[model samples]
Target: MQATEPDYKCGVEVTLEVIGGKWKGVILWHLKRKTLRFSQLRRRLPGVTQKMLTQQLRELERDGMVHREVFPEVPPRVEYSLTKTGWEVVPILELMCQWGTARLQGRQEEKEMAQAS
Candidate 1:
């Protein structure tokens, strides 16, 4: 079912707006493994620029989907993990992943069959 204007006016919409960006899904996927440091996240997501990562992390933090912890040390350290609200998004993501995989497989089979004809 498609969401309406009233749906757009609530927390769900705001959460979607934050996570709907290109890199956000990947970021969330990686975080689902375990809490990660900034550099760790960067390594996992190779193509994302440092600036974009910083921006996305800030947005996630602002949206309450990510918890950022700062360490007092010689070099400043930061780590990120999913908040309770963020954890709630995992099942939705998993279902979407399943659908996407099935859709891709279907399209590939169709293409191959068309080529054989």
Candidate 2:
């Protein structure tokens, strides 16, 4: 019988396909907090190059996770914010963070034990 639900492996693969890049997660994290302009995003991520940030934002916007708004004005203002799909990723991001923290804590404890011995 065909399973009604998506295959777990394919599901994970698809999620990673859209967000596997180093900057994507960081970009998503910031967008989740509040809407911000392009310059604001650049300032928030100090190490990210302008080209890279621009590329990442374009990808996210294409994927429907991020919404880009452009205002016709003297300077042509633009802003970015998370869409409904993007907000859904928040809990997933939190889980990833929690897991990383736990892993780091476990590694530190193991290192301390090794040093003591």
Candidate 3:
């Protein structure tokens, strides 16, 4: 049997549903540059617990935003990368990063001005 699609009210809602969580967007952002192993991702994201990261990755894979490649080896090697659909979200993530940088800069300038006054 095939899975049913989610009934989203709007595009934004659908966007948020897929990437709104604390770790999902960050995970996607990290995978934007290149494929990474689970350990590499864990190191980049300091605050995320192993269990949570695993859960988030599983969700992303299920959503078709991430591709998990497992290599046959003595132990096993798995790497994660963004899917084509995932690449489509990079521009939005970049815009969000720019907006956040601007906000931080504005706050820092405000702080300096207040200190000088």
Residues 6-112, candidate 3: write the lDDT tens digits: 88889999999888889999999999989999999999999999999999999999889999999999689999999999999999999988999999999999999
lDDT of 3: 0.95
Candidate 3's TM-score: 0.92
Number of the top lDDT candidate: 3
lDDT tens readout by residue for model 2, 1-117: 884844557678889877778889888989888999999999999999999999999999988899999999989999999999999999989898899999999999999999999
| Model 3 vs truth, CA RMSD | 1.9
For model 2, what is the alpha-carbon lDDT of residue 72?
96
Query: Which rank order by lDDT, best down to worst?
Result: 3, 2, 1
Better of 2 and 3 by lDDT: 3
lDDT of 1 by residue, 1-117 (tens): 995754566777766697888788778888988999999999998899999999999988887888999999779888999999788888878987899999999999999999999
In order, candidate lDDTs are 0.87, 0.91, 0.95
lDDT of residue 94 for candidate 3: 96
Ten residues in sequence with the least summed lDDT for candidate 3: 13-22
lDDT of 1 at 37: 98
Clashing pairs in 1: none
